[model samples]
Target: MVLKIALIGAGLIGREHAKLISSNPRVQLEAVADISEAGKVLADEYGTRYFFDVREMLDATKPDGVIIALPNAFHAEAAMACIERGIPSLVEKPVADTLEAAMQLTEAVERKGVPVLVGHQRRHSPDIAKARQLMNEGALGRLVAVNAMWLTDKPTNYFDAAWRRQPGGGPLLINLIHDIDCLRFICGEIESVMAFSSNEVRSFEVEDTASISVKFTNGALGTLLMSDTAVSPYNWDTAAGQALYFPHQPENTYVFAGTKASLALPLMDFWRHENENSHWQHPLLRQHITLDGSRAYENQLHHFLDVIEGKAEPIVSVRDGMLTLATILAITKAGKEGRIINVADMLG
Candidate 1:
């Protein structure tokens, strides 16, 4: 059975989600809502219903599932409305602007007993999946440390969208959250975090560069580095050179160091490691696991459809969203305060 979908927000990410949903035979894009006329244009292009208000869309075309891809600040409000109506929803990344908002939305979803999935599409990437599998299978035995880096060349078009420059929508929430959530998926829970950021070289109010360090509950340490000021491309370099097939904007890289072995992957390189008898000469198996065939957005849409069909568990629940958002908020707070912040404290 094809699951009907209602998409909220007509921005780049929302349109990407809509394209994926519409193309899937198991899913149908039924409606779209955005406050801008661009929403109507997208709806017309896709031959789906369009609305200027979310409430009006909900009233007019009641879809089986909704994908909320609005601005970060609008996530909680939009998600709460859908949950109140008992409609399963897939909210885009970061979930909300603040930890308090994330918690409230999570509570609303729990109270309504509706499935709420956050759109952390990295979890659906095939290369990431393999890495996760390897981690689970002890390929990286007793992980020791993880280092992640994502540097991008921000074109003028990035600033073309006024909201992208605002306080709540900078590199941390907009881009780095993917890495943070993916790290959690592979490395385990983060106990505490310290972050430093700067707005240098970018014509925005929010920081364009950020460095974060995490203390995992598993006793593993992690360092995450992100910058939008990178004049030269990084994702593409990783995708082409490392042959790590990432879906879109292929510019992130990761290096995982384990007690038994260590491996470095650019973007989404999912390779196994060969353990040596001696600890000094640990060698990594040079098998490049490519997942360029499937787009993360498409996989995420299918997962949402499965949730609506009652055939699978949500890949990213509202609870997961809360936790990830809380972690990011903690990092950002720490960066601002120049102190380490406990992830547990942000949960409250």
Candidate 2:
């Protein structure tokens, strides 16, 4: 049986989801909802119906599942609507704008006993999944420290939107959140964070650069550097060749150091001592790990279908997404307050 899917919002990411849905033979793009004319245009192009009101579209199409790709602030409300109707949904990342709203949506899903998937597409990447497996298997040997970077030069035209210069609009929230989620997925939960941010480059209300220090619950230390003003190619999206929009630069953007070995991400270059001795006399050997390629968004759609069909559980649940958001928020708070912020305190 083909699953009918309704898409909420017709923005860039929403349209991408619509394209993926249309490409999947097992799913039908039944209807789309958006406040802009793009919704109708996308619907007409895809041979589907369109509505300005989400509720009206949901009622008219009665799709088996929905993909919520609305703005961050509208996530909880639209997701709650679907949960209330027992319609499974795959909500885009950062779950909601605020912690309280995210909690409310999660509670509603629990109370209604409906399935919801959080869209952290990196978890579906084969390289990331393999790294996670190796980490869990102790291949890295008790991870000690990690270093990550998300440095890129976003064109000035990208910030033409008013909100892009506002307080909540910056590389920390817009880009770094993905890396934070991937770190949390591969490493353990972050216990605390301290950070410093600057807007010296663009002088916008949002920061253009940030340096963060994090402590994991499992006694691991991590350092992260992010900048939207840097003209570099040290980001997961570009380095890993995930999307077509960016030029693929095969460089390592993350480093995980452990007692036994150190691993560089995306490149998957493993370094270890050739001998059992931990002395400076031994030379370290480098081993390259290769993984098959797959489109993360397409894999995410398949997982969402499995979740709707009850064949698989959500890879990134509502609670997990909320924690990732809280972690990023904690970093932002730490940068502003010039002190350490506990992840648990933010949740409370």
Candidate 3:
């Protein structure tokens, strides 16, 4: 039984999802909506119908599922539209720009009782899944601090795209939201946040770098460092006008510290040991875990279909999206105000 899928937005990530869904034997790319010529090109490449307006596509194709891969600011409107029509949708991350918007989108999903999953692809990584399983099984002992770093440089052409340089469209919102979701997925719910953010590079309207500390409800503290102005060997040259490649940084890395052990995820590498004793040992793990290099996005799509078919529960729930956004905003507020901020209160 092939699930007819409608893709709303044909941007970089949208094309990636389209490739995965079209390749799946259990899924069929039925229709796509994007105002850009790139969207039409992607639809044609996947042998699917294309529409310039998403609402029109939703009405015409009436697909079993929809992938809302529009920009961060547009997520809420697109997702609310899907759930209101009783169509299951998997939206790309940050869910929405603000907590209020996120709550609205989530509430629609709840009132309509439709399967709407946020795209936090890291939850689907084989290594990430295994790490979470191990952690759950007490391999990591008590969960402690989660330190995540995202550093890179973008080309001037990156801001050439209109929306990316606008307010609410910065590294903290546009990119770190994925890291924020991953931290929430692995560590725990954030209780409060303290942040410091500034535009140190590109002289754009949006912030380019940030340093945030989080207090999780589980009593675990986390620090996230995000910047779009670091040039390193591991960098994949993601600057706009460059060759298209992976959606994330080539040298993706994450560190999770617990009472018993600590783990590191650097690109395809995963490392863990007993406490801080072996911190410097066993540096090299492997090249990459097998089984579909795009597992994160693929699994996100698969899980959405499962919920629509009543076969499984959502991987990332609506509450998760709301809490994560609240945490992020709390961080931004703290950074701007130069003080610690309570995430829960901010959400309320």
Candidate 4:
């Protein structure tokens, strides 16, 4: 059966979702709602109906499932509308603009018993999924420490949007949140964070660079360096070649160092002693973990369809998305306050 899927917002990520819907054989692009000229153009291009008002579109189409790709501020409201009408939706990440908003949406979703998937897309990637599974199975062993880097140079005009220069729109929330969520998913909850951020490079209200330290509840530690002003391809988007719009750079962007061995992602290299009794003096062996040549966005679309059909639950639920948001928010706060911040405090 070809399920019908509607899209709210036709912006960058929304456009990508539209393309996915158009190509997937299991779903039809029911309609699109966007308050922009680009939205209409996109709808016309895809040969789908277009609406300026969200409710009007929802009422007119009554799609089996919806994809909420609206801006950060509108995510909760858009998802709530779907929930009220008993429609399942895939909300683009961050879940909502603020903690309060996320909490409200979570309550509404739970009360309505409607399934809502958070678009972290990385969770759907086979390598990341396998990494989490292996970690759970102690493949990395003891999960001691992790190091990650997301360094890339964004075109100066990328900040032409006012929000991109403000606090909520920086790389911390916009980019590193994925890494944080991946970490949480692979390891465990983050207990506390200490960070330092700088906007000196761009001199914008939002930071262009940040260094963060986190302690995981499982006694593991992590360090992450992020900079939008740097020129490099050390980010997962390019390294893993899974991002829709990024050119594949093919490098290891994340490293998980455990007591028994260390794993580097995107490269999928596992390094440890040749045998169980070997120590640090022994030569290490590198084994490549093979992955299915599947794509993240495609897998995510199939998962959403399964969610709509009650065949599966969301891999990244609304609450889980909110927690990831809280952790990043804590990092942002820690960066600004120059202190160690507890992730739990962000909830309060």
Candidate maximizing TM-score? 4
**What tens-digit string does per-residue lDDT give for candidate 2 at 1-348?**
999999998988998998899889999999999999999999999999989999988888889999998877788899998987889999988788888998898788777789889988999988788889889999889999999999989888898867678866677877899899999999989999999999999999989999999999999999999999998989998999886368888899999998888899899999988776764677889999888778788889999999999999899999899899899999999999999999999988
lDDT of 1 by residue, 65-181 (tens): 899989888998998888878888898888898888888887887777788889888788776776788789887788999998878777778688787898888888888888889
- For candidate 3, lDDT tens digit of each residue in 71-181? 888899998888878988888887888788998877777777887887776677665676677667876678887877767777788787788888777777777877787
* Most accurate candidate by lDDT: 4
Candidate 1 regions off by >4 Å? 236-252, 266-276, 281-285, 289-293
The CA lDDT of each predicted structure is 0.80, 0.90, 0.76, 0.93
Instruction: Enumerate residue pairs that collide in model 4.
Output: none
Candidate 1 similarity to native, TM-score: 0.91
**Model 3 Cα shift for residue 2 (angstroms):** 1.1
Per-model TM against the reference = 0.91, 0.97, 0.86, 0.99
Task: For candidate 3, list the clashing residue pairs, or say none.
Answer: none
Error in Å for residue 330 of model 4: 0.2
Question: Which residue runs does candidate 2 get wrong by more than 4 Å?
Answer: none
Residue 246's lDDT in candidate 4: 92
